[model samples]
Target: MSTFPDYYALLGVSKTATTDEIRQAYKKESLRTHPDRLTKATVEERKVATEKFQAVADAYYVLSDPSRRSEYDILYRTKAGNKSSDPGSSQNFFSQFANMFAGASTGAGTGAGPHGAMPGHQPDANGVFADVFEELLRPEVERVVPWWSYLGAACGAGLGFIIANIPGVMVGAYAGNRLGAIRDAKGKSVAVVFLSLGGSQKAAILRALALKVLGSAGM
Candidate 1:
């Protein structure tokens, strides 16, 4: 089992809160904890306020992202015993996955029939699995290249131009771009795995496996 910060509680929102609701809660909490508002307070008060402000910002950062929020919800449910007590075990985790798949299928087939299938229709297990897998793997928000990458490229090119002119400029630009791309890829992969696994003791092993898979696929 793993313990995680209660981000929802930190933002003063419920687990089922809508995105707009969460945004509003974050705005309220952030304003209350903003360090500038405590300028005349004691040193200790300012320090505490700063910490709370950062925590609120962190809570908003995680909760505002759909993909990360989904992952957090899984861990939250596990921690709250909404899921099985020992979700860290491979067997238990797979069982939960299967249950989720089944539930999805059931929900999709609602009002179809007592047998949970539409008239003259057979459920496509493979198709359903593929959809679920795709959803799990997809990032809810597409990320743009980091601003620092452009800055790095400009700096590298300038330095190279100063040293060796034309050919050096090309080489420097390529190196900078390659480095940035690699760093970005690794960062995204790690973020996905960390949020999905929730940093549990057993989850470390799973995270390693996930990273290996992503790496092998050149993610």
Candidate 2:
């Protein structure tokens, strides 16, 4: 129903935030995005803050619920707009999603220079991973995702479970640090070369870090 979410933006957390980190993020967002805190803000800003607060709350609500998180995992993979019937699509999608969120390898840095859209911003044989990463943060129940960064979309990070709501994603998740990418059901290009995961715990970290990067970038 909304744009893709920046989970970190929603909760005011960082991309590398941990569970405890997210908890702290939720608390901070609860304070900042709260309607009560916007007394002097413009009516429009207050309304926006209210919405962001709700989004944060909703994300926290879901991610906090394990069962809900499983469902979210399923949804994130299965909801591909063009993926009509790839029985394995969900599994494949999660594999890729997990990998990309990891960011560059441990010592490797993959940040785009802040001069403004760099060489990667241009549409190419492979859609820019940075753009794809930015797109994933948008929170859309059902809609074509967006590419731009968000101002406060990552609050939903606190509610990571709600990000996809799929069950048993661990089954398909393999062990490795490899290229991360995205593609439509039709096999159109999306993104290539993201990050690799050490495991689920690492995946969580990467996911958090991705959000933080997007947030800091003001996406």
Candidate 1 per-residue C-alpha lDDT over 1-219 given as tens digits, one digit per residue, 9 for 90 to 100: 433467787778888888778766765565555554443579988777656665565455446556546765776676664332121232333334323323222333121223222322332222221222233333421223344466667777877788889888987877776666566556554234323432242233323333443332111
**TM-score top scorer:** 1
How much is the lDDT of residue 41 in candidate 1? Answer: 78
Consecutive 10-residue window with the lowest summed lDDT within model 1: 123-132
Q: Cα deviation of 97 in candidate 1 (Å)?
A: 21
Candidate models: Cα lDDT each: 0.48, 0.35
What's the CA RMSD for each of the models? Answer: 16.8, 23.9
Worst 10 residues of 2 by lDDT: 172-181
Stretches off by above 4 angstroms in model 2 are: 1-9, 12-18, 78-219
Per-candidate count of clashing residue pairs (backbone under 3 Å)? 0, 41
Q: Which predicted model would earn the best lDDT?
A: 1
For candidate 2, lDDT tens digit of each residue in 1-219?
222334444555544555556655554454444444333578888677656555554444333334433444455454444432221332333334433323322111122222112321211111122232334422321123221112112322323335443322221121110111121112322222122212343234334433564343112
Positional deviation of 100 in candidate 1, in angstroms? 21
